[model samples]
Target chain A: MTFPESNLRRKKLGQALMFGLARAISYGIVAILLLILFFIVKQGIGVVNWRFLTAMPENGMTQGGIFPAIVGTLYLVAGSMLFAFPVGVMAGIYVNEYAKEGPVKRFVKMMTNNLAGVPSIIFGLFGMALFVNELNFGASILAGSLTLGLLALPIVIRTTEEALKSVDDTFRQASYALGGSKLYTVRKVVLPIALPNILTGLILAVGRVSGETAPILFTVAAYFLPKLPGSVFDQCMALPYHLYVISTSGTQIEASRPMAYGTAFVLVVIVLIVNILATLLRNYFGKKVKMN
Target chain B: MRLRRFTEPVFESLIKISGYSTGFIVLLIVIFLFKEGISFFNLSPVDEGSSLWVHNSNPVKKLTAPQIKDIFDQKITNWKALGGNDQPISLCTLDELGEAFTEEQLGAKFERLPACIDSYIDSLPGTIGFFPDKQTANALKNAQPVQVDKVSFSKFISGTEWFPTSRPAASMGVMPLLLGTLLVSFFAILFALPLGLAAAVYLAEIADERVRRILKPVIELLAGIPSVVYGFFGLVVIVPLVQSTFNLPVGETALAGSIVLAIMALPTIITVSEDALRTTPRAMKEASLALGASQWQTIRKVVVPYAASGITAAAILGIGRAIGETMAALMVTGNSAIMPRSLLQPVRTIPATIAAELGEAPFGGLHFKALFALGCILFIITLIINFLVERVSAKRVR
Candidate 1:
């Protein structure tokens, strides 16, 4: 009995060491990442001002405020979401609700998976050639938005499908048993139950497109537009592109530093808001999924 | 037809086509890249002066408006065009802008030049060489372009920076940009993988629900944040920190870029790895406990081993993101076109080079296709990584 207890003590010590190492690794990762973000804010926050953001790019940099970029990003996120939401959802509904086990379903699923794996740069090239070059849009906001729409469509479809599939199958059967048409059951019974999850997925995808840079790079080539976007044809500014310019030697390199951070802060806020909202929704639905 | 109608066409083609539109774009990008970039890799000699041995367009035979501007600025052709200031548009030199610099282009030196362009620009009063977009704005005032052969000085308007066109037909050297891009991305993966893996393990196995809820989205937020923001963050924070730490004259190095990129890639690895660890059945841990094995020992020996393949796939995808990333790398990197020395040394990357220069490349020229070829290279890398990930993940699933 004494032998076993001592052995247990020694074993316990070793386990503690291993757990310490694993915990160290985890803490180290988070600390490093946050340190980096804090460093950005520390070095650049002082320079952010309304005037700096409102100015135009002068002497090869963003001289004015990034109002245009803010608007451009808004348009990009809104436009892509508007386009991706309906089509992706419809496809997901068809796959889960209508299509049974079949080749068509399999092929669609495979394509969706493949889309997630494909690099974002290819999307940039395609957007550049097809939207800007072929379509003669010439690096405008609309072209960028459309390209982003196409890029995010796959994510929207997959996430929405997953959300829809998570709903209890019994709920669907009950709807059908209660003399409900398949279409009506899907539209009313299944959708109401799955709404929170679908919304969470939508918010998550929207957050993604808002922050994406590669696809937008080739599609929207304007360095800094002085005027507000009255049309999609007019070029626009974006925070991501602004960061690119400032680092490359636009103007008052010191001054531009804060603008970059300010934009980062803004982006973080947007994402944080989305995350909080989505997490609440997911939690609400997750409880329901568990209960059933 | 009647029988087909009655059966409801089990292989219904319309149903098959539904939502396959996503596949359509992916296919088009891959095929289009191949088509445009194939010639860059071909490097074969044809009968019409289109190979390495012969000049495709007589690169040395003559100069264009831009070449004129570059060579002339350096005063290479002092006698050909006289009395031009060092600044191309200066009144004393050419008097186009103001009275500051003269237009008399005489007695320019070609020896001991800063780079190829500095002296080349001096060679001819009207000669020019290319500078990237970063240098272009100031370059315009100091250098003026001239028409050469079929290409006009107005060529800048019709063109973008892919200059594959060489007089007498010659091969273009875009390798530096491509190499630079690959190098930064490669280093980024190296720095990010371990940290991200650690986070994943911690989150999946060690953390409480409160910590999980707080930390998960923070990692995920890194994914949602724009790369440009990372780039900006790099410029202001990492660059200065590196500079001071290493006592380097400037801080914008590949290492700085890697740090920012590593941070950018953390969420991807952490998320994937967490999922991998979460899938480890609780029964295994309980069994290890019953057998008197320690919790950590069980996790290391059994849990991690089971998740190894998944972790590797996650790492590859993270690397793919690193390699293909454009704006952040373009921003934080010094954009200097040199083979990287240490992580601390400044270097240009392929994606950054393209983003920096492609806008100004003369359209349909050699430089343009070279950027496309660079894209092709990036695509292949991601493609291989993706395929490997699929194989590994599928096997693990099985």
Candidate 2:
């Protein structure tokens, strides 16, 4: 073969090999994911019955169900959302709408980034010291929720900012031309357009709150609470905490294996559902924006 | 319009307060961690016991922290090492201090007290007693109260053992834990970087649009999975797999933790590097290809070089995730606080140590403070990583 021809063939072979390797590596992710999902489902499905979902645990947590854990997780998610949503939304608006280019804005942005990077366990420690001990909230859902709220706060702000930014400036200009005040334009025009994306953030937050074990572990997770929590002040069992307990610390580790799997499966499903909802909302809103 | 006039200032202030609250929260967390953690340096575990007591005849006036540890660990088998009479040392339990009280004073409620106390200081000339602080006033009449030397800040940081709950001499050294965290994370990076880079390259430069579209969400779902679930999988799957494969008695080795962490770090590494690779200029890529370079050559020589800073940022973020991960590591990495030399050996990371023990550590105790110190270390490490990522990504912008 001539020099150029040989070089072309060699180049084609190299590209083919690289492309084939890349494609194989990409599929490897799918395979590993499927393996995890399949393993969890196969082990957990046997114990994921109605009793497992709705009844309180019994027999040193080797029998019965994880009802209180489910309730506690829901309560934590709700409490965190209550604290996080408005604050996060407002912060997003301030960054994207009110603040232009200032040191304060820059500081806030930097703090948000740092806050996102702060380890979740650090958040737990902080919560235990501040909310649980100093403030005398004790180990309760309120403290756990507040810690988790802080954790989810950065995600909320980022998502809300992105959502609000994606709204056309023309919409704000139009509202202003119609004599709308800044607050009026934001409340009536910008937020409405940003609602779907904001919901996406909130959904993502739900997914985050449900899955978090570290932040809640010290702040609220009760090792064995058979009854549902009566108030925010009451310590409660949570699904993630329950799974941690059964798998590692339970009295009857061998007996509780199925229960542990069931709890994990439930927690995974809750997070997955929230994530799927958020993804779908994001895509739909994205498509709508593109079409517009 | 009429309502807006009244609400505008109120709304604006609210927005400002909420916006700046992130700064407030960060300040509060840092302050709280430092306030709680720093106190451990001067904390005396002797405060927990009724009072510190040595034989009235012993020459040793006070014992330092290491001396106390040595006595408890039985390393100082004789009193001469502690500047006392050259005699065999006897470790006394809290129950042994009850002999100081009378039968009527200990009646019913204190019935078992005298015998308990007798067994503690029984015939042993070099007995060291750690009584509860509640018994301090009563115990001084019978036995001398020796002041517990404060655990110096340096020992806490540099010491190797981490038995925070060890009685009489709770070793709160974080060296093993710090080492374990670094070792596990280093292995995690070793495992994750190549796979993540390969996958990122595929998603960015190799895969068709259709494949990219499908794989992206699948990766997101993996990222979205709750870490506790990952922990469960590690416990049941990786831990046993490691055990059987390595033929170790227990599965919860550092290797199991590293594997789990590698998987956890993959999404961050892949996503960040892919984003970086996508930002490589199309002009540069085309120029490389037009110069008779293969697609592989173009990607390697042009795209990767262009995205180097971004890839570095990705690797930093990935390492950050791996180091900070708590649950999975806690579950799978045997919570043994020993200086680890092998991947098969059980090791404890800083975050896992905190997660496993923090709940039981009393609020104002040395253990609690030590855990907080670990948090401070973790926080600083992550902050440095974040700063590096920021600097690297900032260069990408330029």
Which prediction has the highest TM-score against the true structure? Answer: 2
Looking at model 1, residue A277 earns an lDDT score of 88
Query: Per-residue lDDT tens digits of candidate 1, residues A228-275?
Result: 788878777776665565555644666665566666766666776887
lDDT of 1 at B163: 32
Interface root mean square deviation for model 1, in Å?
A: 3.0
DockQ of each: 0.40, 0.80
User: What is candidate 2's fraction of native contacts?
Assistant: 0.82
Model 2 accuracy (lDDT, Cα): 0.87
lDDT scores for all predictions?
Answer: 0.67, 0.87
Taking the tens digit of each residue's C-alpha lDDT, what string does model 1 give over B298-337? 8788888889988988888888788777778877778876
Q: Write the per-residue lDDT of candidate 2 for residues B303-335, one digit (tens) a residue.
A: 999999999999999999988999999999999
Worst 10 residues of 2 chain A by lDDT: A1-10
Error in Å for residue B227 of model 2? 0.6
**Residue lDDT tens for model 2, A135-239:** 999999899999999999999999999999989999999999998889889999999899999999999988988999999998999988757789989999888
Off by over 4 Å in 1: A1-10, A36-64, A99-104, A178-182, A284-292, B1-18, B39-182
Extract clashing residue pairs from model 2.
B49-B131, B49-B132, B49-B133, B50-B131, B50-B132, B50-B133, B51-B131, B96-B117
